[model samples]
Target: MGNLSRLLKESWTLVEEQQDKVAGYFYARMFLSNPELRDLFPTQMDVQRARLLGAIVTAVQTMEDPDRFEEYLQSLGRDHRKFHVEPQHYDLVGNALLEALRTFAGERWNIEYDQAWRDGYAVIAKKMMAGAAADTNPPYWNAEVLAHERRSRDIAVFTCRPFYPLDYRAGQYLSIEVPKYQPRLWRVYSMANAPRPDQTIDFHVRALGAGYVSGALVRRTRPGDLIRLAAPMGSMSPDHSSNRDVVCIAGGTGLAPVKAIVDELSRYNRTRWVHVFFGARDRDDLYDLADLNAMANKYPWLTVVPACSDDPGFDGEQGNISEVIARYGPWNDHDFFVSGSPAMVKATMRTLAGLQVPSIRIKYDAFTDG
Candidate 1:
């Protein structure tokens, strides 16, 4: 590694060691100096701090070579662009991080350390700007509920008419905000339906036992209910056309986003093979079974497999979805997408690794425990 790369590696290592403290000090400083940022964070400041610490630590630790690390940083920059995180925000974060280092490292902090950090910040900022420039912003979506169907006791399918023209690529998510809740809770829900410029956008929500907005969506939300939503954001879409073989592993309501991907891809002129492996607790919990069945019937290259862990009277593939997927065939031949609980995602990822599927081709979204 070059001198700059070596310095960065060392700095990142130090940051990792003091990750928790750095995260705490960083957020505290931001909230203190810039009161505006205080509201952007959750009510549980400590929890948010820890989560941020863990994410940064994971990102830094995974970065072995500087070039690869820079690529990861660029991706992060692009993701931040969707949230409108400006170049100034990087400086703010860096300042707070440096303050934490000064506090923790004490006498070791020097002019040379500051200069190195300044150089790093400049590099990061430039990369972030470049990423932002390359990003193709998805159309913003906002609407009022037009129709809703209770597919199951826990899951509800909602259709909403866009107040304005809406456009979204398959597999992207909509940030649904419930303003009624104090601090306003926002959760990303994948668009359950294909893009229709003239029609309603759909979201399939699963109830999580008084899960704030989820509970509201399930039992109380009605037609004509105004819902504020941000446009589609996420790279978990059908990006490669030539790569035909596709495998989708979905659990519970996690199938919502993947459904959009499959639905959109089915409409394409050139036929591509797709295997959807859907899982739920039981037959009663499964939604869109008929729709998937229809797709399989209509498209020669599409296949739907439903797996149930505790089938009881039911009879299908009786096991975890990942195990069932492995039993079917080699996972290496397809682009795999997994969406569910973090534990489920971890297990599915391990299964993919064992099957020799490349990590870059496998997309995942762990609905983070907030």
Candidate 2:
């Protein structure tokens, strides 16, 4: 590509050999220098270090491929916006990274190599700054939860005091806090309703096998639960100005964010051409069908498609939501929004890729991991 890109490629060739120590030193140095950041991380530093190491390796690998490296970096740059990571954070990280490299390189470490690494970090920081500025980003914890509702066994909706007084653009989420079995447990839930300042936002939480907070929230929490919360996050909202066709695929409580998105579309009188595919088990286990049905009837622009994987009476569609999308055919023109269990999100994303949808247009809200 260019001088910086070529330098990046050349330096990264040594990454595979030094990957483990690079990540190790980076964290060890950073945590030592700024002990405050320790609270931002999981309690188990070793485990979290491994995770960061893996993530760094993956990121470096992606950068090695020049085809769409900028686009991928831009996506990560956008993601960091949710954390409210600033330019100073990058500078701090870069210092730690270089120190780690120097320690690992030992006698071999030279000023020239250090300069290259510093230059690389500066390039990435500049790009991240540009992306942060252009994205119209907001703070991570700027909103408070006003109210919530229990729609089904594992699905609940919460109303939020928006950081900006306006309607949520659909498919967005809020980071929230709840009593945790662990030392610190905070999670995110998608808004199930359109932006309604006077009312509560909605969230659908599917209890995983042993989801302590989710189970308690679904089974125990009530109207006036004093919930700790962050502002709305995620970039999966639909653009109202564009009439490009859209499809939503959701499973379990993944429907919460999808429903919020659909509700937003309905408010703009843009529902008819949109198709929503929701998958679940039996009738009793199904969530928000009634609300979705009412929306469909109210707006000619929308179509709700529910699929049951196990219900014998499921007369509409059978199998996974992604499968339903495939059978319908011609998804090239439509943007795909996927949410659900990690497996469902992963599988549906694969299916969408196989169907040839542009990566940018295919969005997902990973609800379970929070």
Specify the highest-lDDT model's number. Answer: 1
Residue-wise C-alpha lDDT for candidate 1, range 1-370, written one tens digit per residue: 2554556556656556777777778788877887876655556454446654454444444445566556556655655543456667777776776687667666666666666666765666676567666767532345788998899877888888877766667887766754444233455688887888567788888877536667777777888777767655665787655564888899888888789888888778355678899988899777878888998898888899998888867678888887888898766567788887777788889988888888988888777422
Error of model 1, residue 23, in angstroms:
4.1
Clashes of each: 0, 12
* CA deviation > 4 Å runs, candidate 2: 1-29, 39-92, 95-117, 123-154, 162-168, 179-185, 209-220, 270-272, 281-285, 310-315, 353-361
Clashing pairs in 1: none
**Who wins the TM-score comparison?**
1
lDDT, candidate 2, at 176: 56
Model 2, 1-370: lDDT tens digits are 2554555455555555876777777888898998876666655354346554453434445555664455545545655665556767777777887787777667765666677777766766676566666776453433455666776656665555544443345777655555333323445677777767564565677665655556656666665555544444566877777667888898878888788788777666533388888888766556688878898898887888898878878777888776777888588778778888888888888888888888888888664532
Query: lDDT for model 1, on a 0 to 1 scale?
Result: 0.71
